[model samples]
Target: MSILPELERRFRRALAPVEEDPDPLLAMIRRSQDPKFGDYQANFAMALGKKLGRDPRQLAAEVAGRLSVDGFCQPPEVAGPGFINLRVRDDWIVDQLTAAIGDERLGVPAAAEPKTYVVDFSAPNVAKPMHVGHIRSTSIGDALARTLRFAGHRVVTDNHIGDWGTQFGMIIYGYRNFCDGEAYGQNPVGELSRLYQLVRRLIDYHAGKTRLAPLAEKLAGLESRLAEMHAEAAAEGKTGDKRVKKAIHRQQKDIDEAREELGELRAKLEAVEQDPELSKLAAEHPRIGQSVLGETSRLHAGDEENRRLWREFLPPCLAALGATYKRLGVAFDHTLGESFYHQRLRPIVEELIAAGIARESDGAVGIFFEGQDAPMLIRKKDGAFLYATTDLATLRYRVEAWQPDAILYVVDFRQSLHFENLFAAARRMGYERLELKHVSFGTVLGEDGRPFKTREGDAVGLESLLDEAVARARKIVEENDDAKPGGAELSPSQRARIAETVGIAALKYADLSQNRDSDYVFSYDKMLAMNGNTATYMQYAYARVRSIFAKGGVDAEALRASRPPIFLNTPAERDLALELLRFGEAVDYCLKDYRPNQLTSYLFELANCYSTFFENCPVLKAETPELRQSRLVLCDLTARTIQKGLGLLGIDVVEKM
Candidate 1:
């Protein structure tokens, strides 16, 4: 029933003895760009003509004459520049839809040669809360995993939690020295964030002191120079002297900017030193980073007290993260932390050394690539292992434990070089047979084209962001309900559930509908709209389809059981049928590129086609019973396709939105 494969079959039969290789003209067959041309176009004749030094149009004519697609499609026509166009007959379109109507998978075929995939994504630090930065990787990775699973691939989802790291050191130190026990008992993450911030502020204060003193001195000198210039200009009647006045004005502006910066820097430093505990520690030790690192080193060495503190800090942080993931409907097959691979780091480094892939560079084990400046460090000079070392161990463990065919790391685009070295190192470690890929994504920018954040300029927390989205969506839904008939009658529970569904869908679809490699500005107002490519648009489209069935009193189950013949009478009806039938093709195309946007684009186009059909061809008031039944079937199929497509993106469609 898939058009591409059937056309390929006809093409293979047409050019059986013409070419020596079977797939020589393979990518030439594709959907037509213009509707004036037929449904599918084959540009094989042009390439074949180039090979044989024959006229392309003449070759196309011969190929068109020999094409054997009579019943499925009308006569094949050779167009300009050796493009052969083919259009399917209406009868064949209905036959395909009838056959596809009974299948749960909607006529999409599963992979004939399925491969196993281990997708690693949504990696949040153990005690650090999830924020807006985590959305792209988590949402995109989950969608790709679902697509692959639905396509019959064995997928293992892993959330590589950052449990053992320098951040934990800061937390342990802050809790012991500066924590408010009552505050932490009530809001663990909030109190923990405050503690972490205090430690970080202390570090920044000491580090910025040297720069701040110089800046303050420079600002004072600039202000003194500006005052002298202004006095000289005023004494010289500089109001009429444009050059002198301009110079004085510029000097004053520069002085003002410098003063502002110096003031802010000093204020921040003073605030950090205002904390009594940190001030006392600053006076006593003068260097807190070293102490934090000492605690980190002990934790690495398995200190009992640090371990207990870490255990205490992890639960509340995880609960906060779990709440966010639950709202987004994201789950993981494995939740392995970096601490799980701590025991294997040394052995991994030793194996690399024995295999001649790793060498000691200033007491640190490193892997160097030819023509590269820096060697990726596996072991630090102080006998500490880095993330590179743990990544290597994780790769080996995944391969040996699961024997996966492919492993995808959904990480930030900033770590391109890190993944490059990691993959190269994994290959050197004898994983050449495995397919390793780093699916890097860009940052979510705000309306101002910077990283998304609150109006207060703080990074948006993931849960807070979702909660805001739901609240905003609920207000819109309520507004709609009040403005329309029977909308005010919706109970509070129903409105609440609908708002949650719409809001989460809006957030997820807004992220998924964009090209993954490009930086997209996140705008809640634009993404949650009832029109365009937003999730609300698609949701409303599905609801409209359902409403059609309801108004017509059409029994979808009986219709499916009866297997009625679908007759495409008008241009809109045929276009809709074509779009619906290409659902399988769209899924295949999306799976191949690992781009959910492709599927989104397909569903959006399908919705557009449905809209056109609804406007032009009346379903309940059709000219004949056959036409009405056919349009009803089309509506049902389109709704099902939208539901299945959105579900793959981990989005839900409401029945009565």
Candidate 2:
């Protein structure tokens, strides 16, 4: 077990004698911010003293007296303001490291009581191409699944693909109206993608043309309002007032947003108008929005021709998606797309109505929640089912099939309200015992701080993004290999293999390293760099440790088989050993909140500690043979921990990078 949990158990026992409810106080026993303070610190004395009307220092002394950490940590030292600092014994650290070297899981114990988890992620609309936006969900979800399983949980990964959405309708309409038969015969996926884009562009052009006048007027109104606000602020000399300044700031923001929207609409319309064929198509499909919806309605209503097209188009789309998944090294136990629940959607709506969970609101079937102006519509007035209906069916199917303790939807933050409503409705349907979570993540923004997109304002394709990362990585790999001490020892094929691994690792790490709730600027240069918290750095650290074994011709298997005693002689070695022993703790911390960044943070720290140890201590030329062997064992442990930690994040480490 990790030191924190063991320490917490001891502290809980110590606190039990003094307080009635000591469970909450255990949270105060956390890792110290500064190593000089100690390995861990507990500040519960102040709060407990305040509650009991006692001096904090005296209470800290009493608690310290009751605490027993004989083999685990040194004597608890009471610091300023009744803070209790506890550092793990160096012998205990050495003992743990010795035990870990022989274990495959690096001494990380499995969960005592594991539960089944159903992770829903990588849900791209099959009719459209996967884009940059899909990366967050896919990477985050895969990492979570990997981590959960490593921690000994039953994990079910389901890719709830958008196979039956309006995007397919757009494709269907485009195929009927504008598909090139020859091109489709050769490359169905390419042709279908082209058609989808063409239809979408025409729809957007018409939509933008219709909204241009109103958007321009809105911009003018916002500009006039901002000018009025500025004039008032100037005349009244209220610029210094906080409220007036706030109002003026709000006005300016409104004006800026309106102007930006108007500009985008104009630009979209201009692009189409400049192209003769596109302009003709735009003029021809003025009501493309409704027409697409009509096609979708027919598909859902079981039109024979539309169903045949859907079946024909689905395989190629799925195959293309499968290839991307293979490149990313992501897999799903089940790919239950939205189309799988088509037959159940209507019955689900009827069941909701029968259960009084849904009712007809203005000719539409919906479930209304308290304090909400709009209800979550399941069926539109035109007798067409909505995503909400399909979602309900999917949820029911999963519950019946998997019986998972928790269901996690790895999706973007934009769908927060939709999930909130869905979960609420699910609860009303009597699924109160299960945990339903929306693992919402933020956008991947370009360096310009907008959603990452192509020059033409379209979302960047996932395949092309991978290709670019790998291409860049290949260049860096070749350059580094050529600059090696032996003058390029790696063959072309070896370089290619390393480039592929490094490139994909960089991409996955770049996304996994960020706080999933915050938008991060995606930069290839930053992510691919060989220093700091990048995957390249971690991989290099692993490679550097392995190089010691290679240079000395040391047998790692014999080294482990000998069961050499690990000695933390230097402060650097001690820090590295301490970090190595905390691998299980790091994994536990990560799974606590479903955040892979926690694991990334831990791996980065481990790598840094290894670096410090490598610089301060010489493993091959120690004063004593025993110390040299001990440091070698430590080096092996560090490499194994890095490899395993990165593996948990769904990132691979090259033996040499």
Candidate 3:
């Protein structure tokens, strides 16, 4: 029933004698990129001639003469440079359209070998409100998941929540310090948020103080020492044993410089110690404050209370994230946060130690990869675990649990290095079996060409943005009410439903229609416009077709009773039919690239073709019954195409206006 498949089969059978590879014949079936050329031009003859050392033009003529493809297409004709130009017959178009109307898959086949994929995305930290930055992961992740699912793959979405680490220490600290019992009892999140703010204020208050200045001085001293050592090593490598004395002198100089800096810090601290008021403040502040800071340190070491708090809060926060997923129509199979790999960390550390991949440097266990300038720190000098450790453990967990063919991380470009290191480490550990991909995206810019934000230039909350979309949609729908007969008289609930459909569709389409990795200006006016590539445009297309069916009083089942003879000899009819026939191919293309803009572009062109056909050709007013029914079927198929395409992108269609 598939026109392309039938064409391919016929092409293969016809060329079986002259051709050994089938790819050449298959490539000839695709439409020519340039319209100036024939509908489809095959260059396989030239390639084959080059291989066989035969005359190209004669080879093309021979292949064209042997083709028995008249049933679905015109006789092949040889053209410039030994290319076979194919012009499809009008009947083939008609037959294909009829079959597609009745077919659910629309003649597209599933992948022969489907692979299981794990997609990690939309991982927001608990106790932190979701912002505009989160949209890239949430939206892009959902689209990718949908595309993979449509491509016939079993995809598992995993939201790796930022539910553990130093933030918890601050939260626990600020909770005990600032919690208003009655207020906290009423709302846990609000109290948690208040605690976060209090901690932020505390950190800001002490960060610039003289007491904590020594730690910065110490880090600078260490860096200077390391830089000097590097220079000495370079000198030694260049001069060999002849300049060993020079290298030693350079090394001594670097050590002396670092020691001098440390001595200055010690002298300053000693001076401050002699002054009682300064001494008290220094004790209160210190180079670091709060012993609980040690808990974050031990978290990297896989400590118990830290582990327990992470386990207790991670699931609750994940549940909260699922609520957002419900709103956005995103779902995940299994969630593996930092805590999920709590048990695996020790073994991973032991493996690194045993295999000599990691060594204890300055009290920290770290692994220096083959080409990396910096080592992957598994544990800090204070024996604490970090994001890198959890990520490693999570990567191992996914590989072992799923044995997936592909592990896709739908994260921001900012985390590119993190994933690179993770992948490198996994590869080094013999996980060369899985496909690791990072689907990174750019920022969503504001009118000022920066990341999208509110009027105050702070992060815009997702819920508030969605609500504004609904409000704008309501106004646009109201303005266009006169276009519909009873649109104005509709009840508030009905009006609300229409607004919701238009609003959501606009929001989703606006985001999806842009390049996946490009920063886009978020404009309500642009997104909500009823014309162009906006969702409202597609919805309007569907509505127009529905209006025709309603006015004609012909049900879809009745219209499809027969193929209703179609004639595409006219340019407009041919163009519309051609665009209509491309629906399946366009969907397949979108799935291939994980880009919904492909589908949007096709829908827009289809609508434009419909508009052209509307002007030149009459449907209900056609001179004959056969032409009228055939046009009606075209209209019905268009509506279905728009509905199905938009549905795949998670957009809705309205019946009126």
Candidate 4:
């Protein structure tokens, strides 16, 4: 067992008999800011003074006199501000460190009452390549899973993929109208690309005139009036009238409001820009745009043509998504998409209706959650199930099948409202047994601090970015290591494989090391840097330690071949040992906070300590034989710590630079 539980028990027992509030005493152990003050400190005397009606120092002395701690920590000493400074005996720290070294879990005990948690993350929609937007979810989700599993919890990671959506309607239309049979037959992703292009072309072909006839004329009049106002404001600016500035401001607002209606106008116009044929059709036959959009909508609303196209493209899209997941080392426990919840949607609606929790609003079935001004739409006015219906159905399934203690949704921040409503509605319907959490993170930004995009104006593909990283990693590996023993050079494929591992690890670690809730600027140079908190720095530390041991011919099988007693005489040695022993505590904290960056921060510090220890205490330069062997053991353990620590973060460390 860890020292925390023992300390906690003793603390509670000490406070149990006292008639005053125990929360202060309970918080004292955690109040200690640093190790220099003592391993733990309690500032409860100050808290008790106001409550117990006594002087803070006198109260602390009274508590100290009454409290008893043995076989764990020394007698608590009353300090300034009635602080009780508690220090574990040196023998205790050594014993704990020794126990940790011998134990596989490093003296960290599994949860006394283990929980089964379901973490849903990295859900990219079917038919679209995984993009920069998906990186945070996948990376953060994996790190969370790793941290939780290490903490002895049963973790179930679900990839709640967006496989069912309106995009399929346009995809179907494109596949049927403009698909090249031979091209698709050869390459599925390429074929889907052509289909996506075709659908986009059709969208452009119909965009300019998709607005209602009356609305279009109104918009035209508004635009004309807006242009006239702008021109008038420009001409009036010459007179410098104060009212002209106010009129200009008011006119600008009106113009902006009008331009927003042209959102549909702009999207269609963009599509037209990409396809000459679509552009010509948009100009020559405005009604064709309306007819095409109607058809696309009809298909999305369960049109037979759209359904057929969705069926054809879905499997291929899933296949493509699977390939990306494999490349990124992410997987799911199940493959349940929106279509999987189709059967349950009707039952859910029935259950909600029976409970009187749902009502028909504007021809749509919805549930208006308490405290929420807006209602959650479960079904469209046309009696078709919406995303809300499927999500609710999925929630029910997870509850029935897995019965998770907590359900974590690692979705985009924009979908916070949807999840909030769904969670509230679930609670309202009496699913209080399950705790729901939203692990929402910000979007991935480009160098310019905007959303990442490709030159082709599409979301940057995961495959392309990963491939580039791997390629760069390979170049670095080759530059560092050329000869493969006996004057033979490393093969291209071998170099490529190593590079791939390093590159991907660098990319994944960069994201995992940052706070998941904040947007991070993705850059290769920063992530792959040989210094700082980057993966390369950690890997280099691991490699340096490994190199020292390898030169001494010390292998894993020979770790126990020699027994070297740990000597913590030097300050550097004591510091390194203390840092190494704190690994388990770091892991525990990460699990508690659901933050891998906590662990990352610890790992970085541990590596830094090891570096300083090696610099100050020269292992190879020791005078005595036993001293040399003892230092080697320390080196070996340090290497192992680096390996295990990085491994826990899902990052691989190479033995050489």
Candidate 5:
């Protein structure tokens, strides 16, 4: 229903008589970069002429003559170098606007062929508090699901939580050794989180202590090697030689990295040693790492006490996760945790072995690839099932139960090899027809260009992050509301409500606006700014449009009922209308590559176009009543488009931000 796709469809029909497969040629048609050229342009004639051995300009003229785009565009003009420029008709734009005004979905039509999709994302370990690392997966996955469904796809969002993992083992070990019963009774999840952290800290302390000697030796050897390289370079006067310089540079980098590693290990060890209580605990539990693993094995093996403890601990952990999801406005169609597939893990491994897809590798079961040095391990030598095993079981269950056309894993890029092997193994096990994709993303870095962390080097908690964003947003909201021309118009409760919406929208939009594969530095000031591509700007744009109707005492529904004729009297009006009508095209581009930033870019452009229109064209103050009604319709349409686009990105707009 968008202009480009409709143009492409017509081009496909016109090119059918000249070429057998016109898809490659049709792809050359795109929106013209400059308005002076036209609304859309096609540059396929040169390629087509090359293929058919004809003059490109002559071929373009012939193709343009044969094109049937009546009422949609002007007659195609064969420009220089066999380019075809087609400008849409003004009446066509008016007709589209009129139809969109009365339609709930605007002018965006349902997909002709929709497919079922299963989106797997946000698989945080429920035993620990959700942290900043989980934000990208949760936000990206939710936005993709919303956009795909709006684009007329059957989307199933599954939060495959990590319920049965080693983290739980650490929690169990900590509870047995260090739990405060009164604290647990008061706040089970909080106590469990504390215990998990305590056990993990002790394990890290011991591990660092054990690795301190080897790391120091490695650092010393690296420093010695670097000195030798420098001395050789200076003595031989080979410093100017590119190879010697490169070797020295590489050697220095290695030495620096080694020294940094050694320093971090020493710092961790010192922290534990300085804390009297922690030092005592570390001495008492020197083998915490192995002991935690033993507890995990017992739980997995159905030991009665560990099993009972797991059952008791799961509910509070789940409740905590649910509250966070609620705050973020994210929901999943199905939450199938790792424990759900435990019973089937063994059977899946046995089936893989029977099918010859897997074999014994050093007393462990794994799937080997032709060139891969390391096989995909499904079970350890000690008969403990691994994550890969559970993943295989989950894949089989989804295929059998949902019969989806595709399953997308929204995870970080570090697991690229794991997904590569998982997909390869799945194909070997007869899942060749299904679409398996790994939507990998990069890290969230702090201003220091490293992974975001607290002063203690711990991950920033998700709840605390939300709290800070809201607190900052509340301050902004109160200032703006109090500075209104007529005085403060919002009550405390209303101010609080608006602050929450803006704060959450700012957070979600900040992540959604970036290219999902690139690492982005987090900054509150930039994300919450009143201008640029921030959600605050878009929300303000929407509010500005709504204010036009409110001030005029106009009923938007009644105006739409009147169905006033849309007029593109000025360049600004026409540009705004064109951008408004291309909402469906933006959604299509977004789903084409599973990238939400595409939608964000489109919304930002639409906002800019509307701003231009507002500056140049008046709505309620138009010259005539009919013109006034038409402009009002444009304002309403702009507000609706902005709202719908932001909604698709899992953001809300304030009516008076």
Candidate 6:
């Protein structure tokens, strides 16, 4: 048990006869905000005294005096307004450390009642390469799964990939039209992505022109009329008749509205033209747009040619995506893509309509809620099922298959409304046993506070980003290492491996360390720093501990195997001991709200505490053999705790850095 619970138990025993409301009393027992206020503070007396109409100071004194925490804590201090402060006894700290070191879990307990959870995340599209945009969902969801599993929950991770979508129709069209066989045969992902991009841009460009054609012509006519009106108004200035002046004003106003609409259309076209690649390709293939619509219609109608192309393209795209997931150490228990529920979509929509929850509105089949302004569209007017329909089918499959206590969709915050409507629809459809939660995350922004993208205005590829971070980390490791001036002691491959570990760790830690709800600016200089709360810093701390054991010939593995007794004999040692024992509490706290930053913060503080103890306490040169052994035990536990904590965060540490 942690210190807070133990203290609360003692307080409850003392307040049982007088206080009946346990929630308020429990709330009173919290970790002290400041160290000087003691390790934990209990203001239960003030709350109970108010109920009993007695002086709170007297009640505090009675409760402190009645407390039977002889060896565990010093006398509880009742300060102004009946604030009760309790400090753990040094011997109690030593006892807790001894228990923690002897146990494999380091005194962290598993959940007494574990729940089954299904976490859905990392939903990358089939044809599109994984990019920086995927980092948050993949990393954050993986960390939550790890943390929850560590706490003994049965977590099922699901990668709800985007496999069946209209984008595939564009891909099929592009492959049939624009693909280079030699290039595609060598690297299918590259060639398919290229074709997809080209076709998508061409389609968009042609659509812009067709839609804006009439507006453009209208604007031209309006501008000519406005020019004449401006000149006429200039000539008529103060002497023109009232009827001519009014007519000119009205005509000019009409021209202004037309110009505004035309300007918006031009801006849209300009934005599409901003991409040099898209601009060139669009100009080269001006007729590609109509072909996209034709292909899309054919694919939806189960065209054999499009189906064959989709089958040929999916394997390589998924293989390329798997490489990025491997580098990030993210894995899923099941990768059920959108196509998996394709057949069930029709049945689901028909059932909703039969059940009277859905009806035909004009041409579309949708569910209309009593208070909702817009109905949830399950089927478009054209006999096609929507995303919400697929999601509803997915819900039924998960319920019948896993029966999870909770289902968390780790999606971006932009789709918040979709989940709200989805959960509402699920409830309406009589599938209401499981909890549905949208674990929304903010966008990853660049330094300018806009969405993170390259200067060319395209998302950065995940593989390229990892490569760049690894190269930069390798350079830093090479420059700062203690290798010989002429040559390094480590081989090139060894350095490269270390750099890869550090680089990947840095990327994951940087993303996981931020509050999930806040958008963080991605920066290599800041995330890869050897100081501050970076993965490099955490790895270095672990390395320092390993180095100490190497220099002193302290066998940590032997210590752990033999289960040495841990005891703290100094202030710094006790502080470090307290932090080390809080590992389970930290993990529990992290999963309580599914926030990985809580775990990061705990690991960071533990590192700082270990640093303080390492500086103040002498291990190999202790005053006595017993003291030295105790300090060594602390070192071993600290190292193990760091590794375990970092591992839980989906980050790894090298023995040396």
Question: Which one is best on TM-score?
Answer: 5
Taking the tens digit of each residue's C-alpha lDDT, what string does model 3 give over 1-657?
A: 444556677778767888788775576566667765656667777778888899889988997787787776778788888888777777888888878767765545666689999889888777566776787677767777776776678888888877665677666666655578787677666677667655653454344344446656665676676667667767668535546657656666766776665555555455556768556644564433354476556665667776675555555455666776677777778776665676777788878788876788878888787777888889877555767888888888888888899988877777788888888878888889888988777778887886786653358877677788889999878777745655465567877888987887788788888877787788878887767888888888788888888878888877777657666757888888878877767766776656667878888888888878878888889888878887888888888878877777777788876
Please write out the lDDT profile of model 5 over residues 1-657, one tens digit for every residue.
589888888988889889999988988998799887798899999999999999999999998998999999998999898999999998999999989988989999988899999999998999989998999999999998998899888999999999998998999999999999999999999999999999999999989988999988888898888889888989999979999999988988988898888888888889999999999999999899999999998988999999999999999999999999998899999999999998998888998899899999899999999998999999999888899999999999999989999999999999999999999999998899999999888899898899999988999999998988898899999999889887897889888988998998888889989999999788878877756988888898899888888889999889899898888999999999999988998998898788999999999999999999999888888999989988998999999999999999888888786
- Considering summed lDDT, which 10 consecutive residues are worst modelled in model 5? 522-531
Question: lDDT per residue, candidate 2, 131-170, as tens digits?
Answer: 9999989999999999999999999999999999899899
Off by over 4 Å in 5: 228-245
- The clash number for model 6 is 0
**What is the TM-score of each predicted model, taking all chains together?**
0.89, 0.95, 0.79, 0.85, 0.97, 0.88
- In candidate 3, which residue pairs get closer than 3 Å at backbone N, Cα or C atoms, i.e. clash? 297-384, 300-384, 300-385, 301-385
**Deviation of model 5 at 224, angstroms:** 2.8
Judged by whole-model lDDT over C-alpha atoms, candidate 4 comes out at: 0.74
Question: Residue 509 lDDT in model 2?
Answer: 92
Q: How many clashes does each candidate structure show, in the order listed?
A: 0, 0, 4, 2, 0, 0
Query: Across residues 1-657, which tens digit of lDDT does each residue of candidate 1 receive?
Result: 788888888888778767777475856798998988989999899889988899999988887788888789999898889999999888888888998889898888888899999999999986776888898999899999998898889999999999899989988888888889999988989999888877776766776687797898898899889888878877878766889878977988898898887777777778667878667766664577778898888998989998888888888888877877888999999988898899999999999999999999988899999889899999998899999999999999999888999999988889999999999998887789999988888899999997887763457888888888999999988887777664474678888999999999998899888988899799888877757988888888898888878778888999888887888768999999999889878888887767889989998999999889889988889889887887788988999999998998989998876
> Over the stretch 1-657, how does candidate 6's per-residue lDDT look in tens digits?
578667877887887777776766876687687899988888778778888899999988988888878888888899989989988887787777777766767778788899999999999997887889998998899999988888889999999998888778778878887889999988888998998877776776687788797877887887788678768767868337787778778877887888776776677579778978668877877877667767766766778877787788888888988888888888899999988888888898888889998899979998887788899898998788889898999999998899899999999999998999999888887767778999888998988898899875579888898998899999988876656454555667878989999999999999999988988899878887757888787788888788779879887767766655566767788888888767887887788688899999989989998888878998889888777888888888888888889999898988766
Worst 10 residues of 4 by lDDT: 482-491
User: What's the candidate order when arranged by decreasing TM-score?
Assistant: 5, 2, 1, 6, 4, 3
Per-candidate RMSD vs. true structure? Answer: 5.9, 2.3, 8.4, 4.8, 1.7, 6.2
Score residue 49 of candidate 4 by CA lDDT.
Answer: 84
Better of 1 and 5 by TM-score: 5
Q: For residue 476, give model 1's deviation from the true position in Å.
A: 1.6
For model 4, state the Cα shift of residue 330 in Å.
1.7
Output the lDDT of residue 461, model 4. 80
Residue-level error in angstroms, candidate 2, position 37: 1.7
Give the alpha-carbon lDDT of every model. Answer: 0.86, 0.91, 0.74, 0.74, 0.91, 0.83
- Give the TM-score (vs. native) of candidate 5: 0.97
